[model samples]
Target: METVKLGIATEYIPGRVNVGLYVSDNGARLIDSGLDDEAGRKIARMLEERKIPLQRIVTTHSNADHCGGNAFLRKRTGCSVAATKLESVVIENPFLEPLVLWSAFPFGELENKFLQAKPSEVDLIIENSGIVDESGLEAVPLPGHFLDMIGVRTPDDVLFVADSVFSEELIEKYAVMFVLDVGAALETLDRLIRAEAAWFVPSHAPASENIVPLAEANRKGLLRVSEAVLESCGEPASREKILQGIAGRFSLSMSVSEYVLNSAAVGAHLSWLRKRGQVAPVVEKGVLLWRKTR
Candidate 1:
C-alpha cells in the first residue's frame, strides 16, 4: 500500500509480494507486479496519483504471486512486459503455471488465482546479457527458484533478488520452500553470498545492506531439506510417502495447493541428489521409489 524509497529513482512497495519501482525520464518500470487485478490496480492508482506513467513491467519469473498482476497492469497502463524465455511462455499462457504443478491438465481445485495468474503479453524476451537492453537495468541470472528467474539491479545499487531465498521465519515455518531446481537454488545462494550490492531486496524478506546471513540461512535450509530426503529414503520411498513424511516431520498441515508445491520441492531435491549420484530411483510394483545410493 505504501512505497519505500530506496534511492532517488528506485522505490519498492513491500507486502505479501514486493513490487519494485524504478523511474527515469521516459517513464516508470515496475520490477514485478503482485498477485492479481487488485494488486495491479492498486499499483496503477498509486503511480497515476503521483503522475507517473508506467512504461514496462519486468517480471522476475512466472510465479503467479510475482507476475499475476501483469495482465491487469498491461491493460490498464498499456505497459510492455518483459521476462526471460521459459518464464515468458508460462506468463503468456498462465494455465501452464498450475498445469506444471498439477503435473497434467489441472483440476478445478488447482485453478485458483494464487496458482494461475491472468495471461499477459511479453513484449521483450530478456537474454543473459546482464544488461536488460533498453531499460539498462542489469538482469542478473538467478536460476533455481523458478525457470529463468532473474534479479534486477537498478543503477542505484539495490538488487530486487526475486525469490532466490526465503525469509528465515518462512524457512522455519514451512520447512520446505518450493524450488524448481535445488541444485540451481544452492548455486544462486552462493552467488548471493558473494554478491556485492548496496542493498539486496528479497521479494519475501525485508531488504538489507548485508544479505550474507539470510543467504547462508537459505543454503542451510535447502541442505536441511535435502538431508531430510536422504535420511527418509535410507530404506527407499515413493515421492508421495517422502513428501508426507517430511510434512509430518515439520508438523505441516497443507491444503491441496501447498501439497502440490511441497511435492514439487521434494521432487527437485530428488533430482539434485540423482544428478550428484547421491540417490537412485527404482520402480517397484509400478511405484517409483528413490533410495540414497551412498
Candidate 2:
C-alpha cells in the first residue's frame, strides 16, 4: 500500500484497489477499504504512525474487493461507515453478494472472501448525489459498476472515482469488464468527461490530472464486449450459449465464480442492447434465446 498525497487534505493509498484518505476538521476519512484484514491493518497502522485520526470510512460500493477491509478497519478504529442504499445492505450482509451473483444461495466456492467480505455495519446512508453532510465530501453518482456505486470528490478538487473507469492495459487484458448496467456505465463516462478535477483517482487505474482519455478507453472496452455479445447472437443462442461464446472468443477458462460474474455482465449487455432495439429475446420450443434484432 503506497500513499500518494494528492493535496494537503487528500491522500490515497494505491493498491489492487486504491483507498482514499481525506483529512477534515473532525478527523481523517477513508473513501474505500482494500481487499482484506491485512489491508485494513496496514491502513490503520499507517494512520496511527502519522498520528492521523481515523474517523469515517465511506465505501464506493459493495464489491468484496472494495469493502473487504471494512470490518477490520471499523473494529480497530471504531470509525463510522457510510455507503449508498443499494451498497449498504450488502456491505452489512456480505453473503448477499455471492447469493445475488449465483442467483441463489451460493455454492461453497462462491463463498470465499474474493466473492464475499466480512460483514460490517453502516452508520450513514448517502443521498443519491450531493455533499455528505458530516464529511462535507461531494458524492458523484458513478453507478453501473454495481447498483449504486459513487465517486467521492474531496474539497481539495481531487475525485476518487471508484470502478467507473479502468486503465487501458486492464481493459485490454480483460476484454469483458464486469458491469451491471452497460448504459449507465457509458453515461457515467460521459459525466466523467465533463468533470473538472485537479486530479482523478480510479480504484483500478493510476491517478491523473486528465481522466478523459482513460474514460474513453473504458468506453471502447465496453463497446467491444457489447459487440462480441451481439456477434455471438448471429444465431439465436441461449444465455449459457452466449456466455460460452464470449469465453471462447476471449480464451477465458473460468471457475464457477468467473462464470457467474461474466454471465451477469453479459446479461447486462444483452439488456442494454435490447433496450436500444439491437437485440430481442425469442422463445423457440420452450427454450428462450437472444437474437440480433436489427
In lDDT terms, how accurate is model 2?
Answer: 0.91
For model 2, residues 126-205, the per-residue Cα lDDT tens digits are: 97589976767899899889989999999999999999998888877767889999999999999999999999999999
Candidate 1 lDDT, tens digit per residue, 64-142? 9999899999999889999999999999998898788878988998998999999899999997448885666889999
**Residue 160 CA displacement from its true place in model 1, Å:** 0.6
TM-score of each: 0.98, 0.97
Worst 10 residues of 2 by lDDT: 127-136
Clashing pairs in 1: none
lDDT of each: 0.91, 0.91
TM-score between candidate 1 and the true structure: 0.98
Instruction: Name the top TM-score candidate.
Output: 1
